[model samples]
Target: MSRFTTQLAAGLLLAPALLAASAVQAHETGDIIVRAGVVAVDPQENSGNVYVGGANTGLEVGVDSNTQLGITGTFMLTDHLGVGVLGATPFKHDIQLKGVGRFASIKHLPPTVTLQYYPMDKSSVLQPFVGAGLNYTTFFSEDLSSAAEGLGFSDLSLDDSWGYALEAGLDYKLTEQVYLNATVWYADIETTATFRTASVPSKVDVEINPMIYMASVGYKF
Candidate 1:
């Protein structure tokens, strides 16, 4: 929680100055620059913890992976380092079970604040970076089966979730402000919800350690 406050402050102070930089066009740019990138994240493949209105070990829910559409921006605050923010559409991933078939999409919103270190010059062709950050994931629009009638599902709710991020990526510079960047991050987001489909309402906790891979084109100003 304390970390969230620090991130908030940094974001508040940084955005206005960065946005203003685009207008002046003549100022000596800070190594602390801001960059926007189009990010495409790999599909998420997950298996663990299933919830019904009640606790039943026999039932399980499997989630299918989906391609993620998103954008990530970084504000370089120093010669070799930066802070970043990530925004994306509510991630829609499918839930599948071998016998019960596939179910609805579960949506998630992940926002990250990272400290980045770039290892090479922009003209060097191949530049790599590493970062450590915090990821906050929130769940919404949960659904249940029609056959799951008369279950305590109405009492179910999803609590907000979050994780720690360790990231690494490579950048292929094509031009001054145009480049290709590929990144992979490991996240430990603890997500859980109530299952009302069972006779008694039971809580199902899922620990998802997701390995996210993203590739994108970017512009720096």
Candidate 2:
């Protein structure tokens, strides 16, 4: 978690100012642009009120951020329009229970496909764009901590989620075929979790709305 925090802080400090950099060239129609960089996932989670033994109980849930290798590919259908796909190495998040401590962890993959529109023409040096898309998140490898295990927590699982994604980005042309890119994305994700305790099964709803950030060098072909 500390490592993730450090990386995210570093990116926050570096990217925004660079977004205003001047461009030298821009991509054209029929071009394929590929980019690679470090990506961060910061979850803004809101948990449902937990109920046990048929009685309402208060519980708080939180998620820690993670950074991973990020990659994206965009295919230009026209000088001003493109289709893009975003991907990354799986992200793992630590799930902490308020007052109770870190109780579990989960891994997930969010793949998104978006339609992007560039405001500048191919002759311009700077390209600023906006995009909208669909995001599908799949969760796996859910595990309970030793403390949770001791408390009879087992068979933990989380349901998959499908949601909408929105994005904005800037590309500063470095050369005719290369550029620097910075992008930010938001996704709506909500899921339900279920687990077994010594006495009975328990459930809770978790909303993991996340903000994702990326900065990468891109190549056009």
Candidate 3:
């Protein structure tokens, strides 16, 4: 299993014991929570056939996953509702062509804003929340592989994307001001990659729907 999965399983196994220990106030109106941790973006990608000079090339594109540092902050509008924003360091992904090896690398940032609902009482130590939001992904520093350069590929770029985001998370209070947190998000991301091959302009539409996971330590203020 993945590291995130293993950690999540361990956390769940420990939840019962933790929950039985004591009741603590987790969220309150006017509170702010900040969390920091590792985050992974795993893409479920699909792409249209690469088009060279407006003609189909019969080859599809793919994108590999990445991990990076993540940070999030939430402002409690009420004990049961909050607005949260997610940020991360730039994530780098390898781009591949079907039946071919990796040909490029690209970096992107996904910034998300969500409205979250915490259903449990404010006194509950174990806080579980659900959220819905919007994500904006901007791609930059797209570099072609050496092999791709030799094959006449140049000027790689991917268009920016805007899409919906969904989230679920759990937090276990470790102290009055600190907690252990785990969160997962699903984002709908699409982009068009444009470049040139053998002096011919080329483009391919790509869907990079990704599941994002994070395990964090949070502090309330």
Q: Quick one: best lDDT, which candidate?
A: 3
For candidate 2, the lDDT comes to 0.88
Alpha carbon lDDT at 101, candidate 3: 77
lDDT of each: 0.63, 0.88, 0.95
Residue 72 local lDDT, model 3: 93
Model 3 scores a C-alpha lDDT of 0.95
Residue lDDT tens for model 1, 88-173? 77776655543666544567777777887876653355768899999898878766544333333444456787778888877666
Q: Pick by TM-score: which candidate is best? A: 3
Cα RMSD, model 3: 12.0
Higher-scoring candidate on lDDT, 1 or 3: 3
Off by over 4 Å in 3: 1-23
Q: Report per-prediction Cα RMSD to one decimal.
A: 14.7, 14.8, 12.0
Candidate 2 lDDT for residue 169: 94
TM-score of 1: 0.72
lDDT of 2 at 117: 95
Candidate 3 is scored at a TM of 0.89
| Model 1: number of backbone collisions | 9
